[model samples]
Target: MRISTSQFYETSSANYQRNFSNVVKTGQQASDNIRVRTAADDPVGAARLLQLQQQSNLIDQYDGNITNVRNSLGTSESTLNGITNILARVKELTISAGSGGYTDADRKADAQELTQLEEQLYSLMNSRDENGKYLFSGSRGDTPPYVRNADGTYTYQGDQSTLSLQVGDMLTMASNESGYSVFEQALNTSRSQTKLTSPLVDDGRVSLSNGQVSGSTQYNDRFRGGEPYTITFTSSTQFKITDAANNDVTLEATGEGKFDPSKPGGVTFRGVEMALDINLSDADKPNADALIAGHTFSLGSKPDEVSGSRSPGNTSSSQITGASISDSTAYNNAFPGGGAVIKFTSASAYEVYAQPMGPDARPVATGTLTGTPATKAKIAGVDFDFSAPPAAGDQFSVKVDNHQTQNILDTISEFRKALELPVDKDLASRQKYQGALQSAIGNLESGANKVAEAISSIGARGAALDVQADTNESLKMANTKTQSSIRDADPAEVLTRLSLQQTMLQASQLAFTKISSLSLFNRL
Candidate 1:
């Protein structure tokens, strides 16, 4: 076939252009460290590279988020640790206060120190993050979690829900615990009580153990609570009881132990049970008989306001000796109104009288309470066993209740109260202080456990974040390597390809020149 020189030159020129373009592309790939500069270079590889880049960017973003989680979790762990330490210190202080050796002044000083500890605990509970967000406020990050009430009580103002952060594609972790759970709920120490008081034990022959409400299921079912009973022994063998409504209780020896102030026996009259100590000394006989007088002992549904000599119900053994459903429910029913106050008019009597109730409240049920070594006065469900010589005018009281604060606050308050109490405090006062202090100590251990649990969860969340971060790092490294293999050209391979392409281009140009010059003239 006869080929024209022009056609040959055209073909050779096209070859040279192709070679030159290949060399330029290889050199660019080597210099730029990329294999596909545009989609046209490698369509499939370009799409894959795009996907890998997105994955890499996502991994990097997660790493950043994980770093933030770590910071928050670390801060939470440290803060909880601080709280636990405060609890430990408070526990130690409580033990010292209950020793019963120190005077009221020593306890007051300890209470002052406890006040500082409470402040520290409050500060920790209300701690904020570096960004000024309350750590324990749950999702309500902008608001403070705890607020001090007007009554000097601390209240939780934050929601109970926790905050969480996304740590992985399908994983989310709780970043914080609610303030209510960590502080308020866990440390709740408020309780219901039916405390009692004992008469003066100045007469050694008449030693009185603190009195308590054993139980009167019938009394609980028949009468409203918070009512005090007035037991007036008409004689050594007989007595009469009255209620807040002035209802009369007939004292018939229905139980084995009868209400005989002259001997030991149990008397059950109108669902109330009391043990009578007939073993009274000669001095106690008149005093025990004097219990026949009206308003000998008063029982308030509320706790007593017993302060140093300046308080009500502070004379003689005017202290809570026993606590039960203080013979009535008329007390708990008196909410939003003044608390019930049950005071004893005389130390010689085991009878309690209901104080005047609000106009709106129902009259409290009153019944006779006689105590004996054989059958003790049952308050609530517990029994009271004691032997004491009574003197007329020896008084005691039973107050309803107070909402004591959490472990730290209630404990500190009780300790302070004990310390400030006079050494001449009635036997009931001493027992009450000791019981409250001991209860506070028990509550502290549980509070510490809650703090520890919170710290543990924080640790677990931190570990999870660390694992997610590590996984992301691994994926990032793999993504980079795969991305390089798909999009980048090796320098050595690129250089070699560029050299071959240049050589081919030069050879094509030389051939084109030779062919163009040959023609029919050179052949002739």
Candidate 2:
């Protein structure tokens, strides 16, 4: 083939340029230790490398999240430990305050210490994390979990929303626990408060044991939210038991049997059981006969927190304040069907009706509200003070439920109050004090157990986080190895390719120079 001098020079220059470009590109690859500088170099491998890198980055982010969660768990665990210690101390002080040798003055001293411990416990319960978020506040991390009310009772404001953080692909774990689970759900003290209401009979003449709920299912079914049970001995040998509504319950609990009075056995009703004790001897046979004839004793369990709400249809400025279950028996009587609703017939007069109030609903009890700033009244078993005279037709519903869990802080506060009060040297006062102390101790122990469980849960989550972190690290290492194999240039191969390309470029340059000089243009 015939070729012009210009064509020959052009082909030789293009070949030389191509050889020079290869040498420079190989040298850059060796220096950078990268096999594919761009997608054009290795499209499939480059895409694979990108995916691995993204996965690695995601793994790092997940590891960071795990670390944050672990930190939060640690803070909570430490705070719970502090709470456990404070609860132990409070229980010790409560038991010591009940010592027979300790006088009222000693009890007051213990109360002072108890108050300080209570403050400390409150502080710990409202502990904040490193970032100033409340540790046990659940989803409301910025808000305080437990707040002291005006009446010295503590209320939990935080919700039960547990925060979770992702530690791996499609995997999440709880980072916090709600204060409700940790503090508000402690075991309820299972003792009844007994009152001898028969003015004619003295407590000394006939007394009963401190009652307890022996059967939970029975209690729940029959107690009717801690309705008070009244035992009335009709005669020396024959007695009758009645529920809150004045209905006889003798057949359901135990068969009617003659009591010798000298050998009085236990009486079980609803799910509660207590022994009747007669302090009168044979010499006091007349008193014993009188006690059996008309002596009446009422036993009732302390209800959980009482909640009252104004009816939405009511147009009134009046509010129910200091609402409480004053008498369990009456309270149960009030709710024979369901909840109790206080409907105002006039501004001063009101009537309580059984729940599911209808036009034909009958009032269970009727009373008139009259007093100063607050008018105190007892309906059924519920007691409440009215803030202002309600409008005619204004209604309020009161609900008293059976005790399931006791607030830890409230338990502490109640114990403190008991210690602070002055107890007279009387049988009644002594019995009251002992009952209050026993309830406080039971609650404190249960509260401590709850805190311990929370600590254990935190520990378990921390361990799980550790395992997840390790797994992430392993996954990251494996990804890195795959990324390296696809995207990294071998040191020896890059160096060898660079040297060969340089030699080839040099040979091309020398050959092009020799051939160009011998072209027809140079011959001319």
The global Cα lDDT (0 to 1) of model 1 is 0.58
Candidate 1 residue lDDT tens string, 142-191? 87776653335444546668877776777877777787576554432323
Residue-wise C-alpha lDDT for candidate 2, range 1-524, written one tens digit per residue: 98888898898889888988888888888888888768999999988888888899899899989988988888888888888888888888988887879888999999899889999999988999888989888888888887775457766667677999889997898888899899877867555656778855474766666665566678778775536778887777667777778877787665553466668576677776666665666777865566557777787875455766676578987778777777867665645433567888888788887654556888878998757743677766667887777889998866444566777888889888888778857666655676678678777888888998999999888888888888999999899889888888999998988888888888988888787677456657
Task: Kindly give the stretch of ten consecutive residues in candidate 1 with the minimal lDDT sum.
Answer: 304-313
**C-alpha TM-score for every candidate:** 0.59, 0.75
- If candidate 2 were superposed on the true structure by all CA atoms, what would the RMSD be? 8.0
Return the number of clashes found in candidate 2. Answer: 4
The TM-score obtained by model 2 is: 0.75
Output candidate 1 Cα RMSD: 16.4
* Candidate 1 deviant stretches above 4 angstroms: 1-13, 187-192, 195-424, 490-496, 518-524
**Counted clashes in each candidate structure:** 63, 4
Q: Which stretches of candidate 2 lie over 4 Å from their true place?
A: 190-202, 209-278, 281-402, 521-524
Residue 137 of model 2 has an lDDT of 81
